[model samples]
Target chain A: MYLVADINVEICAAKSCKLCTQYCPEANTILYSDEMGKDQGFKYGSAYVAVDRCKGCAQCVWVCDNMAKNNAIKMIMIDQLPKAALTDNITYGEKSTTAVLASPVVG
Target chain B: MSLDYVKFSNGFEKFMPKEYRDMVEHGPFGKKVSVSQVGSFKEVLEEHPMCAGCAMTLFIRLAMVAFPNPEDTITVGTAGCGRLAISQAAIPFVYGNYGDQNGVASGLSRGLRLRFGDKPKDVVVMAGDGGTADIGFQQVLHSWFRKERFTTIMLDNEVYGNTGGQESGMTNRGAVLKMAPLGKKFEKMDMVQMAKVAGCAYVATVVPNNPRRVESVIKKAVLIAREVGSTYIQAYTSCNIEYAIPTDKVMEDAKAVENDRYQFTEYVSEEAKQYLTERYGYKEFLAKPAAAIPNKA
Candidate 1:
């Protein structure tokens, strides 16, 4: 339902806290193994989050502080996270499963 | 809006300009203007060199009292001198609007004690009602316990004068003003009580009914803190502007404060008289002329 990056950042963007591996609605994302990067002269992971098929839902970003701060992952087309854009004081559950809203036509 | 005072939030919000010109850049002190001329009046500071105004005077005085070497000493407060700590006469300083200056003063004093290590008494904290009473109360309380040898001045005008007339923790009972239009119903807090219960080593309350007394109380507070260490002074100041009262009548209100002169009954120990006389020189301190803001610093 949603895409998560396979890599992680070494530092959280705003408070500079520890980084968690890529979190997605499906919870398939994991750490890229390398904490320290030679290019940036610090510990960091690549940001490869694909939020296109995200079903306009946000679960992965809640767990990732870097994503919240720098917005490394953004909606490609449909609807961007308007509510999340205004506030960032939330946390995510361990399971990053994408939640599907029950559309009236579904049942 | 017809009051003789103006809000001190800088150049941006230009809600009231005429009041700003008369009260701030050109002040009520040392000026001779009739009540009718408030709207058209512009402050033409007399030929004599001025010490800016209250916040400026407060900051400058703090530097003289705290930093001995003229090189050290930082100040902190909110709005006017509190927020924008401007340097005058080569003195290093800091300022901010209402909040705990305790942390800033504590850090600076501790730093001076640790790095300079030799000078822990070089920082002065000057705060207003909103900062000292609302936010910075915790910090100042902790600093009192920390026993750092820095002095803190709580300028009590009762309301949060800088923030568009909000009710502050210090607002007096029945004092009808903005924000608390029905008049502040809650009991006004006694900061001296806070200091006493929290183990503040020294405590004093001085008013400008007699400016000499104010300077004396201030000087004595600084001296005692410097000598024995750790103290606070709640300087009871009246904000004629904040209350939308005429500035010309401020002196009358100041004199009236003598009637309500702080009753240090609760916290004052048996040795209060000796302490007042020896420390603040309270009796003599009270003798200074009403208009005399001692230019000691």
Candidate 2:
């Protein structure tokens, strides 16, 4: 199981608070992408969980629920998510258009 | 060791947990990070199982960010709501028995000093109001009196939040709770005054309303504790559940409390003032306005 942003991206508060992205243990697991926001009809970008990189620590969920007071994230079984969302080459907003970067494995 | 263990072996890096690897590379272990740079970096604290909108957890998170030398820092925590988030931090934590945090930290800081011998190894005791002002009052006072080289932080929620809501010494007078059926008879214990009287070199009281100020206070306290005598910081981290504060209104309630009772106050001894001025070149660290509370609304 891994964590996912299951709530409406409009109320994510990723651009302002970004507590989940700040506290997540894994790097690149949660990223704020402007392109992702545009796709979701949000003016400012919203945070999304890269399922392949997420360790299911639920740090994002906790921060969203408690710190940001926005219930925008949740944990779900890996099989419950579609296979398309579970990609090793998870691209970020504008940066992904140039290069497809794989999740960082080491420091 | 000398922060060498934070790195993983060349071939074995892939096998390591992403959290551990990320901490080694991007975590604020040996770097200088302020509260403003919070979201851009990986924090030492991770996901916690504490209550939603827990002010104590938020305080703990900000405190973790303020450690001057997180790689060499060791925190001691007692059994309370504070520990639920403290023990989850990336830094090594010593979870002592009920109200034994000060006692444990006294020995731990001494041991670290002997072993490191001038190398900075900060020992911080973070506990709830019941643990500091009530259950471990003796140890806390004695440790300060003995001038142990460490920092003691009281997460004062004004009530015993962990083992059901009970009236603690820090609880304000006329506040009705479980044990105090007819409202508390006495005023809240003035631990801030007691800490000053007990020979703490640096003492301060703050609320977690402003993250930057909280960061500055904690960093200054930890730095002072390293060179000066004992230091103390009391943070008013209200309990949302016990106090019946709405999850969304936690920060608002804290702001209200800060304005009414827990105004930001700092008491730096002459020795500490001189040390800070000379060492860090901070000439006006103590000249904060009486009402420094920012109107962030």
TM-score each candidate: 0.49, 0.77
For all candidates in order, the CA lDDT equals 0.45, 0.76
Candidate 1 stretches with Cα past 4 Å from truth are: A1-107, B1-72, B79-90, B96-98, B119-121, B261-297
**Root-mean-square deviation of every model:** 25.2, 7.4
For model 1 chain B, where is the 10-residue window of minimal lDDT? B43-52
Tell me, by TM-score, which candidate is best: 2
Candidate 2 lDDT score at position A32: 54
Docking class of 2: incorrect
Please list the residue runs of candidate 2 whose C-alpha ends up more than 4 Å from where it truly belongs after superposition: A1-107, B285-297
